[model samples]
Target chain A: MRDKNLNSKLKNNFGAKANDSRIYIFLVIVFVIIAAIYPAFFTSGSIKALVSTSLIYIIVGVGFTYVMIGGNFDLSIGSIINAGAVVTMGEFNRFYKIFGGVEGGDSALIKAWILAFACAIGVGLLIGFVNGFLVAKVKVHSFIVTIGMLTTVAGFVYTYSHGNSISANTYSLVDVIDKSFVKIPYLEVFTPRFVIAIILVVVFEFILLKTKWGYDLFMVGSNKESSFFAGINTVKKVWITFIISGFTAALGGSLFAVSMNAAVPNFGERGIAPLMFVLAATIIGGTAMLGGSGSVVKTAVATIVIQSIFSFLISMGMGFDAQVLAAGVVLGAVVFFESFSVYRQGLKEGERPALVLEAEQLRLKK
Target chain B: MSSDNSASVVTLKSNTGKVSFNTIANRFGVFLMIAVLLVVGAFASPRFFSGANWLNILSAVSILGMVAVGVSFVIYCGKYGDMSVPMVMALSGVISVEFMRYGIVPSFLGAVAVGAVIGLINGIVIGKLKVNAIIWTLAMNFILEGLIRWSYHGTQIYPDMATAVTYKTGFLLPLMAKLDPNIMNIDLTMRAENFNALAQTYFAGGIPLMLVVMVIIMIIGYFIQSKSSYGNKLKVVGSNYDVGNMSGIRATTIVMLAFMISSICASFAGVFITSVNKVGAFYVGAGYDFQAVTAIILGGMSLSGGRGNIIGVAGGVIMLGLITNILNLFGVGTFTQKMISGAIFIVVVAVNANSLRKLGKDDA
Candidate 1:
């Protein structure tokens, strides 16, 4: 009996380790499936496309993860992306006019790209600051507040643009985005956008893992009251995180607009997919959705894996609509499956399932 | 025990402040905005006060009212809702139309069943697994959308030949036809003929089935929320799980029951919507979850759980209906209307919180 008990404990410990490793395992399995289906998936062209798309999503996802990790959500990101697109395109257009560039093509394209990106990021920061302030300081839950913003800003997109598309005047930016560049190939160039995504992940990972603000974020996420007790100035951390999230999402929006070559009014309306997919990626990467305890690196890798699976599916003749349906089914099933362990624990304890909620709060205490 | 006394004392203290004062205050924030809007609308448009305008308001409120009723349960239970009400409504409409080939009853049942299943999944995930209700429900929403899109191949569901040609088009058609010719140029009327009439007309052209149903559901919801032992249990569960567990309430079960209630309400709304609209689409429940949530918040139901009743939610629904009506009467643009509604929602919720705080309970 003693030996059996000891063996069971060892097995349990190993099981816990495996569970933690499940996300990585899942990513590998997905990649393997993609590779098996499309042998050419590993080629430079495919990798470049996958990496570029993954970079855009990752940038936005990482910013969003910051808010989720802090125990809130920003439904406004999609609309914000739309807003960013509008802002960038509008600003780029005006700048081109002032600088007297040729219509639809430009000698000043590179400088215009830089200026547009900077302006886009600024707008993103401003929106994020407002969102963060309303939620943290004004004491409103993120959902209601963001929903309000979604409408107001979505309206602004229509009002400012009068429901029209805005295009950048920089042909060079478009040229750089659509095709290869130099011998490196923009597709395989490890472009600035890709580099920016990586840098963001690394910087955020370091800050979250090592900085005082990072610790405060964890504390606030874990338990708001306790964080208050710890003198973390919990509200400031919450507000700042939300603001940073907004800023990062805006940057992503600008890049996305550049890649797409036009800023469509519906840009933000399509945020549902990005929002849910990012959440799934974050959670699958072993970040607790309950808040805190996640890494941007994990989210970044998971984004690649998810995009690859999606691409593989598309390549295999699954229509775009079916893929959308499949994503939803996958998300629902994954959340249900992953959370089953906690439910089972509740069952074993002969306690009501509600007892499991305590685990979320309990983790914070630890 | 001491804590129990303290809580009870607090509840009792707040109970004396005008039976519906809390709800009124919560709604008052939005009401104030609506009042301003009414003044502006009346000044802007001469037709704003016509009896026809009031009828238009009632007609418009019917469809969203169905959704709001269903979501009220989820909010009341403190479950984060964002489930596939839109898809459920759309699918229910589709399935119903398909069944209309066979007969009316079959179509109605098929549509409602799909809605119930959607709600069932929502309940299992949110209630049983204790996942983040909003995230889980949001996922479910997309999945339902995917299903609807795939099944329809991204097309809208239109009325069936059998229903359109055979059964007098459910009962809302002719009434709307008559009303449409005299109305303003605004095209917001339910394009599907049958729905407009059923919602607009009642028995013998007097009371609308939609309004009757709304009232019935509201009353039932109120009874469940206030008078039933089960309702009391849910209240305790939502208010504070620890205290509820100590009090011998199974918080998980209570929460699940709440979700089930919400799903049923959503299903009922779905069937009625199909009957009325004669069509369903991806955008059916697009902004509804948030809208209903806003209404609940404005109704003074605390987000932290267990503080208000269904009557409060009813007040919110009515007020929201009123605001939409007033806006339409004045010919405000859709984009502007959305902004006004959103801003009003935020301010109303804020004011609701303040009132709740003043009363000594956390407003959440």
Candidate 2:
């Protein structure tokens, strides 16, 4: 019996490790195929651009993974990003005017940049707190609350910017951050944004995998009642996840704003596409939408893979609508296959999914 | 022991009373809200109470009401709501217009056929495959939107001259003339007139045709939902899929039927919308899915499903219409209007969650 137990344990561990590496393997295969189709895709410049553009999604995907793993969703992340961008740009412009339009070498310029970053992050935290409070304390559904916040924050962003793009000639600080450095083979370069995104992915991955809080979060998500009974503060953990989600989204938005050197009122108003990217990245990274398992590093890699696909599509001369359609198809196909696997597993276990089980219990009680 | 029993009985009586009161309030809340809005509108703008304005409200809400009714059907089956409704509406409208040269009946049938095909896809994926309803429908929406946009090459299609000529001198005019000779006089050439004006044509006592159609649909919806065996099966399936299946309810079939009904209603609304706009475009049904959902929730239907009625949904539709009309009268911008509606949606959902909790039916 002891030998049998050990063999099963080893098998389970190997199975998990294989599952974890599946996304990376898939990504590698996709890269190889793309490179075969377009030799330019393998060039360093194309790679650098893809990584740089994917950084924003990677950041947002990491944050969203936390929320999803904690059994909630933050649909308002796109609006948060928009709000962050607008506030950052608007504040910088306001500060520049306050300081007599100083161009460079001024303490006022630094102060303005600092204030803008703080304001952007602060707005994210505030929205996150509201989302957390509603879902945790008020017991409102996260989907509805976040959707409401999505519209409300979008409205505020438009109102603040008055449907205009905020632009300033004195965006030297942002420009510097966008500057590429450390050229790799084939003339590819990394930007500060790419480095920052990598650091965040590593740091968050460590936090989720190597901390007690991470275990608590997963426990709370997978079995809230048991976690609560075990004296874990599930509500607080959920709240913190939302705050992290909001903060990451804001960071992404601010980075985007700085890179572009402008913020438009209708920023992120294209609707659903940004959110879909975040979701697709996280899911492709092996994060289950039903909650309780995910990895930030995997998500970051998944974002790059998705972005590379987008780049390939663009190179093939597909329009924005076509790209969106492709993304949707990919998302649906992934989810369908995942669900089918889970359904097969449930059948093997001789049990229904939790949702059906809960519904059955509720009916029986009546 | 007798005194304790008596006290327990009193508490139980009060509890039952409170439950009934809550049920009543939930059922009539939208109507109460609408009544208040109507009164306030009358006081705020004299024209709000005018016959022309009422006709406008009815015509505007006719399409929305149809969509909301369809969403309510899906909700009744415990599927939350269908995100594909808007796309289905747009697709159906586009298909009908694209097939207009094939004649009116054939084109209309084509639209309905498109709806049926989409519905079948959604129902199979969500029902038999048991995919998440919202996500699956959302993906389906994107696919439909992409197909429509690709086929149209991002261009709008107007009614062809042949169809226009037919409307002018063909069966439509004669049908209208027979329905109301006074309204369809020779002075009004159908070719030069807006097709929507036909929808606005009044019957006896100045009742708009759209209003009559809405009333008929609502009555039929109410009967089918509240008085039919199929509805009973749907409720059972929605209430508990596993239990219903165990009890031989064919839960998958019931769920698919609910989705089919939803798409059928959406197709009908699409035809109406096309008639109203006289043009087919990708954005024709934009925002209707969310709007319909908001209306259904405002009608006190639980998002978890197996609750609410068509009458309540109509009241919700009217309440939304009044709110928008009042906002427009006050010159509120689109952003603010969206914010207000979104806020209201959240509040209603929160309240619904609380009620579900009280019933000990929290999904969590």
Query: Who wins the lDDT comparison?
Result: 2
- What's the fnat for candidate 1, on a 0 to 1 scale? 0.55
Q: What tens-digit string does per-residue lDDT give for candidate 1 at A1-366? A: 545554564466777777777768887888787777689778787778888777767988887778878888887887777778888888887777766677535456556666777888887888788888878876777876776787777777777677889887555676565454444643464676677777898899899899988878877887888889977887888898888888877888787888878888786243236666776777777776668667788888888887888888877888766778888887777777767866776667864333454564568779
Predictions in order: lDDT: 0.71, 0.78
Error (Å) of candidate 1 at residue A74 is 2.4
Residue-level lDDT of model 2, residues B1-364, one tens digit each, is 9755754554465567754444555678888788889888988788999888887787779889888887788888888779889889988887775445435566678788889888888898888878878767877876777666655556565653323323323213345445655533333233323443544577987776667777887888888888998888887877778888999898888888788888988887886787678777667887788788888888878777777888889888988888888989888887788778877877777777765554455541
Identify the runs in model 1 with alpha carbons over 4 angstroms from their true place. A1-12, A103-115, A177-189, A268-272, A345-366, B1-41, B160-208, B275-277
DockQ of each: 0.44, 0.36
Docking category for candidate 2? acceptable
Model 2 chain A: weakest 10-residue lDDT segment is: A1-10
Name the DockQ score for candidate 1.
0.44
Cα lDDT tens digits, model 2, A218-306, are 88888889999999998899999999999999888888888888887665344336777887788788887778888888888888888
